[model samples]
Target: MATVAATSYVMYVILRRDLQTKLGWPLGAVCTQAAHAASASMWIFRNDPNTEAYTSNLDSMHKVTLGVDSEEEIKKVADKLTARNVDHKVWIEDGFPVCIALKPYPKEEVKNALKGLKLF
Candidate 1:
């Protein structure tokens, strides 16, 4: 299911490149995945491939952006993660969601652990 969801997400981006122009950024998938993980970890352990819940949350943020049109969206994402007890650092460039830095977590070590597990 995870693989299917990941694939669908990639395909969605591929099919929506034109739309992504205004709503695009480098590492958008990574950012979206991070967003999903952050939100899902907060609400519950949503392991389902169905994206209704996660996309709903993203839609809510998008709606809010329609009015504020500032850092509100990015801040809201970070705030949601923080409110849910997820320790993360966020960087927003030019009002778009940029890099999300997990606080105090050895990302390289985590990647190494995943590699050791042969998950990649």
Candidate 2:
């Protein structure tokens, strides 16, 4: 009998480039937004099996930060993920969408949904 290896899990963070370019937010501010989204997503999905597996091996946990051009782009991605039933959270501040974070999932399962996005 052969055994298959478990798929590695990862969290994906998406931020809007305009947060800095148009809003003139400092780099630290942008980073803070991403952090907030990531944290919220992890907490929201903490009970999920994949989140458990991903966090159990702290050294192996992975996160990828991607960028979008504007708020519209961010909402588009959020809608797409929702349509696909992907677990994620869109962080909003002052009534504006700041960024988004996807809960831990097999990289292959969510990579396609992020196609065309660039690293932040």
Top-TM-score structure, candidate number: 2
Compared with the true structure, what per-residue lDDT tens digits does model 2 show for residues 8-112? 787999999999999999999999999999999999999998888788867777888999989899999999999999999999977989899999888899888
lDDT of each: 0.34, 0.89
TM-score, one value per model: 0.26, 0.92
Question: Model 1 — TM-score against the truth?
Answer: 0.26
| Candidate 1 ranges with C-alpha deviation above 4 Å | 1-20, 23-72, 94-97, 103-120
**Residue 104, candidate 2: C-alpha displacement in angstroms:** 0.5
Clash list (residue pairs), candidate 1: none
Error of 2 at 3 (Å): 8.9
Expressed as tens digits, the lDDT of each residue in 1-120 for candidate 1 is 433222122101101122234455455664464454344333343343333333434423211001112344445545655666544445434445443333222233223211211110
Winning candidate number (lDDT): 2
